[model samples]
Target chain A: MKIQQATLHHLATTESTMDVARNLALQGCPHFTVVVADTQTGGRGRMDRTWHSDPGGLYMTLVLKPDMPAADGLKLTFLASLTLAQTVRRCCDIDAGVKWPNDILVKEKKLAGLLSEMQATGSRIDFVNIGIGINVNNDPARFEPGATSIKAATGATFSREGLLDEFLGALKTGLQNTSLPSVIQQWKTLAVSLGRPVTVVTPRETVTGIAEDVNESGALLVRMSDGDLREICYGDCFHR
Target chain B: MKIQQATLHHLATTESTMDVARNLALQGCPHFTVVVADTQTGGRGRMDRTWHSDPGGLYMTLVLKPDMPAADGLKLTFLASLTLAQTVRRCCDIDAGVKWPNDILVKEKKLAGLLSEMQATGSRIDFVNIGIGINVNNDPARFEPGATSIKAATGATFSREGLLDEFLGALKTGLQNTSLPSVIQQWKTLAVSLGRPVTVVTPRETVTGIAEDVNESGALLVRMSDGDLREICYGDCFHR
Candidate 1:
């Protein structure tokens, strides 16, 4: 939980920053330790899905020891996304919004993505790695389905280092000052999926509900068709 | 989720099988896969603690995609300890009991220990690795304070493969047939810390209470001196 002990490792190319940061976390790395790679050979997303990691994107992973309950894992993810959205807004003129759970989108197009890994002993969480891969200076056509980078969205290239510094600076301040409720309120302001009808798809089942608000743990509290509140902690969400 | 896809790796020495199995799981390895090392160079316990891994001990980790709720991560740990305790009883003829969250002990001595890792996307759990290390045939003098091997306790050598095969066979059956409720009940039967005065230690605070029972999530339900039931999901427990 010592943010002042932050260490940064910049790599030419690696399989994944998350993998490297994971090894560092295993070696008892302090909180806010970071690993950034120019390119990743084996970047991954949720469910072991492949993440396209070309050279122009920003690939970074931060190792954190929150010393909070297990539910704080969810809160960390939301905190990460909120900072990411804010960074995007500051780095570019476009108003970036967060999709429920972990995606950042601008104008209904995918802008950046996040993946997290948690290592724990029973209920005691040891460390969490928040891996972020943002399409910074790449062509949207390289990735699929409405993906846009800063250049693509604004037609002006931006410095990845500038953006990374901005994002991490904001993150350190946010982590130090913001309460969970306040973080949730800020996230609600930049949320694009809340208050909309949405379909969330899991590997096993699909649930459709009115996307209400997220709880303190960053769980999406959905009011289902049966008037029951379902706090979904996992899934791919599509805003309708 | 495919138990049939179980693959076992037996090695003379490795850093940690949990690290090896985690790589496998990240590469989309199927569930129920296992990694066992005859000797480990760097075994680990919870909260960044080092687990001594000399030769003649059973060091193993199972990579499973339970696809359950996040709380099921706790259930998996209890299930592993319960099965391990049962295997020790069957192989060594000594009663083994679980210490609320992590350690399994025989007659107040440490018999085995467990560590778990969970990866998820949102509320969807991707995979969980429950790593277990047992003092099967090691010299108790080599390990410190309260350590006892099955051979040291019963004065008989037990086959490493034999014990592992037995535990896995029983685990497969237990995972398939027994409900979580039944599993909890079985765990309750082997609980040594329950129904007694205990102290729980977290990073920030300590609490003393009666170890009433664990809930469905394998969280210890402590009846505090304040006459309230506190559901403790994380901490080190000491029985008084």
Candidate 2:
């Protein structure tokens, strides 16, 4: 289905786009509503990690109200990462690959991070806020090691508005292909974490295995050393 | 591992025990920390549904910090439900059975409702609060059509503190048996949703099938009429 028309809310500064966008969503904001901020003081990533939101970076949250099961909500993360990588490749002429879940890596250096939070009743989702922190002109490497920005990678400053517009367009088109099998198939084409030896650390236990593939629900399927396959729904993945 | 000592926080009245217990959990309260309220002005169930927290009911929340992934956090709901059923059987002589996720049913009538909320960093769970509202001496049938209390079921008044104490003791023992297979196995013995035709309404779709069994993570497995088996992770199960 065609996504609703994009509604943009630009803020000079905010605590976090996720909070602002969540408030708007709870107040019955339409789907695809966007909240962008110049900077954030309390930006957060997956697992409640702090996200460095420098002034030159593009920090935004997209409010989505998809008519899908809460379990399928994580598929949007994969869709987003794939679309972002494609967007980066098209707009900046830089080849970007996606790490498992939703991290964009340009030549094995972090370019963008995505965090999705949802509130659901039973299996139905009320709304999901996809918080995105893309290091465009900001020097993320100064604060976080192994981080890279578009300007640092290409040595040319790009317009944040143009990049956001291009990304939104691509995402709007991507939302039309929301089927599980097709989305997972398309995402695997840009995945960098698959077909590699990796260690995934969850709260319960750590599993070291070959990153074989991702399931239709977007869970990482790993082939362990003991001939057992482990499906990691969510974890901190490290490529060994 | 041995469970921690019990810590109680009794309130004459509160907005909700979940909020109070969440604050306590965030403030580093010990595991098995208990927060009880004589009445709740703003009680809530799963999916943000308003919980009818009238007087003469046992309303409480348990703070747990299990060293498990967020994916496996739902297992705690099953564990809680099973323990609650056992508690009712032993204390009130009422044969309580669990309905799918976490509702306690006595003779096909609702006796209690359980809601669990958690916060995690990646797959690591920081804390989980299990909110429980059980009808003790209260006439829940006055408000909820299909709900019953211990008094209504057995024609005898029971002490709220006694029920809470028994449940906590049972839960402490249950915490010792946290293995996935064992917890799911024990939970299955008291499950009323299994081996029956159930209509599950999720946020995405409505699935109707014969409930076969529960997986290790406490997800319900259903055999569809189309000869396909579907694993429902979270949904509202209605017996047909």
Candidate 3:
């Protein structure tokens, strides 16, 4: 779907685009409407955690109306992460891979992240708010020790609009391919977890396994050393 | 856990509480911080649809840092719905029940709803923004035919703070019992769907069945007239 509308906030970066988009959506914004800010004064990741989105970075949220079940909504994040990784490669020629769930990484350093929110009435989904922050033209020193920007990793700086357009375009293409299994295949090719020793952390406990692959529903399949395959639907994975 | 620090935005409504909570969370806000708005100028429901939250209503979002997996985040909605339903019952003698997934209803009319957004590092949830809107003092005639407010149903005027306090108290107790199976029991008791003939609507198709029960992970079990039992993990159900 072509972006129905794109509202760019030049120097008026707030802490969250989800807020802006929520308001916009409530005001009857069409699907694929977008709110992009040059920087976010208060940027956040999943779980109410802080995400560093400095000036010259990409902070935006896309408003989508996918007439799908709420449980299938998570698939949008997977599609988005893949689109972002592919966009990074196309835009900067950097080797970008997905770090399971929704983090985009370049050679073990984080490049971007995706957070999705939805409004559902009963089982029918109404609208989805997808917030994405990419470390674009920001200085590498601005990020934490584990984070890396495209400029830092590839020493290449692209216009924020150029990167956003590429990502949005890729996202549209990805969403058009609604076949979850096919999308999972494309994601596997760009996945950084497969065939790697990893630690999966949940609130209850941590599980160590060899990252195998993801299923059609986007659940991670981890192979234990004892040759047991575990389907982990949710948790954080750390490279061991 | 006690609400360590709470932020109330009376009449300080927004389009999305998730956005407000996300901003607060990024600003190093303490966990359990709550943001409540008397009414939402831009209220949203599931699937990117507009929620009609007029003035004198209860619209709030809580920021939480739960040490739990992202998949388990759905439980927060269940718990919050229960709290809201229970709070309604406490505030008025109205019979409020939980509709499967995330709705609080009085008889067949919806009184409140829950929407959860999360930030995740991997599988573990980093933080969650739980947004809820209750039709407290709004005139029932002003709402959609399917919607009803507390004042409309019980003929009682409630101070927003009184309702918030009750909701927070109930939420605190509900979150303490987070085990999926145990909560399912509480949900069953409060459920208005069980044993009712209902129509389940998905994006792809619709199925009509008798609402049987919910499983350990909160998936609904529907018994078809064909003598087949189907487990519906997600979908919108309407009483037939």
Candidate 4:
């Protein structure tokens, strides 16, 4: 659905957008609702991990109802990753690529990431909340060894509102275009893991292989050491 | 951590376990926390969709920390489903089975389901909130066409507290046995989809295949009509 109007919250740095959005969603907020923070004192990523949100960074979460089944919720992560990459490219001249599932990277350094939450009622999806954290103008030194900011890469600072508008616009368009072939093509254009050696780490085991392209269902294709191609449905990929 | 000392809410009815758990979790509640309601007025499954939670039903959500990567958070759904099946058997003396990804079934009717949410800081999973809904002692008329209750199938009325305790006990044991092989074995024993004709419905498309078995990482393996075995990472499965 098209977002007619939205609200923005510029916090000096609060706890987390997920926490805030969860509260709002429970309170019966309308669809396409959004919450953006300047910095998050307790910024978090997927899996309950902490994200350091320095000043001048972009942290936001949008509450939406796509009226889709809960099973298709994973696609929102791909859509968010593509939107973030496109937004980074628009805000800064440097091209940003997506690192499977959700991380957006600029040449191996992380630029942005996304986390999505959905509440399902029986067999149908009720609403989806997509949270994103982008390193727009934050200092690179403030992050871990693998993280990088847009300013650090391109020496440019983008207005957070402008970036949010573009990101949300792209996300709306991406969600509307739900055809598998089209989404896969768009993801391929922004995917950085294709044709690269990557190590997929999971709680059970680790598989190191050459990163083949992603499939229509968003599974990563990895050509294993034994010359057998393995499709990884869910795992964290670490590019070597 | 062992849940030696905990306050368990064994309510005859409530709204939603996720809502109650979120309130408690936000109040700095300790880990191994639990909330069990016999009936939920606003019970939710995934994607914020409503579910039927009549009186004498089982609606609960547990708050816990597994201290793993955020990406492996989906495993909580598997662990919870296993615990649910174990609890249903122990409480009602009826053989219950698990469907891939989430649901627990008994004689072709769904008896229980699971929904998991994780709080992550960057890439590390902090804590996972797993919400489960089971049709315990409710009447058959309370459910939709495809749903089943424990009383309807077994003609038994289970104590809500007894089932909650059993589920929590099984969950604790499962979490302690972090070995993937052991968990997979337990899951396989409780799974009913093995070697069955099932229709897997995804948001993008539907695939009708024979359910083979769950792989090492807890994904369902389906043998398609084209003589190809497809691994379904995530989706809702229905018995045909």
Candidate 5:
């Protein structure tokens, strides 16, 4: 399951890297298998929302078979985000922060969004396919109002391949060294949502509160106006 | 949707009520659509394990479109288990208790099991289909060693349809009255896992500890031998 020994599938265009990676994983593909697509016509984020995966964006899905419970599936998402933020800081010298759940932001503009899907039986996860769409050399602002690319943020074009390689390497190292406890701590350090007045919208209900912190299990702890705490596990969070 | 107003599709036999209910939901079925089967050729529990859904058992799937985030999905399972436990207590005077995740036990013998599946995009859940299999008059002991039926427990044959009707009515009432906060409390009251030494088996890990409590988000809290508390969101638990 080492990244260095993982199989790499490079495609010029695909409907979605998530779909391809899921297929490969179900077909008994090796762990840490990487699927990189130049563009995705049917790329999707959480909730089946379309992701504008243009030619210059880094559209990829990492297939991982971690020796962990399905309840800990979000660990991979947190690790990927931490690595991506560190990779941006080290490579482009640009400060990047993670929004709760899966968005990577640079100065409040989204630089990347991650969507992770897992196939599990009961509480045991068979494989987790993490689809990452990073705005690299592409101009994402044309489609999304709050979006920025590495080139747009830094005013310099960098190799997308180099960025991906750095992230993959960092992710491997993070996976090796970081346990669930440390992953949460490292994620909090790069998080931008804490200590902000936020509105979270789920399908059934909405809650408005000050984002206090994220609990150990990755649920967002929000302090309401009444001083009561609401723990949100998943939703679209808007900073007020 | 009201239970009385729900569209109940009674089948003589099916591969699984979950598959039928999922298809109906995808085909734009209304909320609270129920699919019930006399038996299933391919009944499954958590982790895709087979469930012996023989004739005379109450096999059904309830399709709900709750206006809640996908994070609140487990609340439905909790509600279902609580409602079922109450239904059994009132209908047959058999004391039933819920095990963590989704199991119903009567005096340490499993009487039923629940499996829930949801289709959602982002954090918005379109629908959640809850599959329930309750042994009524059927003898499940032949298929499952640690199984019991209402008949087996009471030595009295009961009508399966009557049991399903009672459960559905109770479930609809529970859904209407129970919020996420109260659901956790109610679930805890009927839970038999808490305050017991248990072993939980996931796909890649095994955790053994004293089951402490379930959090507001429906995660089981286990105190390890080292006195470290671990929150397990999903796993198969065995009382030790």
Candidate 6:
């Protein structure tokens, strides 16, 4: 679907744009539909991490009905992370990079985060709601340490609409390209976690390994201390 | 988690067993948990098809947390379908088999159905709720033309609790076996759709194909008319 064909719903305040986008997807909205909220009362990230969605932050979610296996949906996380970093670089002229799985950072500090949810029947992906939160014009100092926004890092404000447009364009290009290898190559260039010592934690156990590379299925390939390459699917990654 | 540790809340009427199981799963319920209702006010099947959930039918759902990839969860569909067929064969002495993906049939008529829902973060499966419905004593004469219950097929009344026990045992065995190939082989032995002429319909279009073996990913591998093997993840299948 064309990016311009996407309906953009602007909300002054809401619980989450992701929830609203999910409702639209359930109601049979077409692909590439978008939902944006200025303030979210209950914004959340991956692993139930709470995100401070104040007025200056851009909290947006896109409803995509990609005709691919649910496993292939993991590629979208890398696609989105690249788009966010590219948008930050272009809009604010800062060197932005991606952390493994889903965080976008500038100079080893987080500037944005992503959370995606999917509904499926059997192996077919029904629809995926990818929620993107970027600290555009927010003051990260009041939020937490190691969290920095475009405005906080550059000491300049940004237009949420402008940055969102840039991201949607890059995302459209990436989504239309079905070549997983090529998209992953682009992500590897922008990713900062490769070859770094990290700890990955799942609900059951935790493993410390050197971040090697993301496999074809979008799982992180980590080389453990025992010299075994483990594919970690779901976990929290911490740089050591 | 143990099967007996699961408290069976017998309800006279409710919306769905899947909904109740989901609530319990969210509220810190351990694995192998179960919820069974005597009657359902709003029963459902895969693809939003409604099951005749009147009194005498078994409406049940179980929550299982397996440490595996989300893709592996598809095996549970094949697992539950086989379990339902085994339950019917043991209890009613009828030759029951599975229809592709998620339906249990006796002589080409649907005897029971399976619906599985999943919640996850990335590729790790958080918990899966496998909902099953068997038309035990419910008279299907007035229900639908292509449906039959155990009582209608055989002149015998069976206890719902006994059949549930048999199914739970079979399901536990399938869930514990992390080997997907063996589970698929078992399902293949009991599937009626293999090596048959079939029609598959998605929201987009319909295709005629020869039903082939299932792939490693639990998707139906169909040899389409164009001489290509298509792995259909989601669709309605009709045996021609």
Best by TM-score: 6
List pairs with backbone clashes in candidate 5: A46-B122, A47-B121, A47-B122, A121-B47, A122-B47, A204-B67, A204-B68
How high a TM-score does candidate 5 get? 0.78
Please provide, for model 5 over A152-185, each residue's C-alpha lDDT reduced to its tens digit, 9 standing for 90 to 100: 9999988888888888888887888545567988
Chain B TM-score of predicted candidate 3 relative to the true chain B: 0.91
In order, what DockQ does each candidate have? Answer: 0.37, 0.18, 0.13, 0.08, 0.18, 0.44
Write model 6 residue lDDT over B1-240, tens digit each, in one string. Answer: 123535566677889988898888879788888888889988888888887798898898888878877667777777878778877898789989988788889888888888888765566677788888888989865879989889888878888888887788777776777766778788888889999999998767787899897766667888988899987867789999
Candidate 4, position A8, lDDT: 53
Whole-model lDDT, model 1: 0.81
Residue A69's lDDT within candidate 1 is 53
Residue runs of model 6 more than 4 Å from their true location after superposition: A1-5, A179-182, B1-5, B179-181
TM-score of each: 0.73, 0.79, 0.57, 0.60, 0.78, 0.91
Residue-level lDDT tens digits of model 5 in B60-164: 899998775554566787898888988998899898899998899998999999988765433345678888999999999998789999999999998776777
Q: Where does candidate 3 stray beyond 4 Å?
A: A1-11, A22-28, A46-49, A119-121, A179-181, A225-231, B1-240
Per-residue error for B6 in candidate 5, Å, reads: 3.6
Stronger candidate by DockQ (3 vs 6): 6
Docking class of 5: incorrect
lDDT for model 2, on a 0 to 1 scale? 0.84
Q: Relative to the true structure, how large is the alpha-carbon lDDT of every model?
A: 0.81, 0.84, 0.76, 0.75, 0.83, 0.82
**Model 4, span B1-240: residue lDDT tens:** 123435565566778888888778768777888887767889988645688887777688887766664445666667778878887887788789888878888888878778877654333445677898888778645557778888888776777666676777777777877655567777898888899999987666788999998887666788999989987655778788
Q: Which lDDT value does model 6 have at A49?
A: 81
Candidate 3 structure quality by residue, lDDT tens digits, A86-150: 98898799999998878898889888888777654433345778889888888745558788898
At residue B142, what lDDT does model 2 achieve? 90
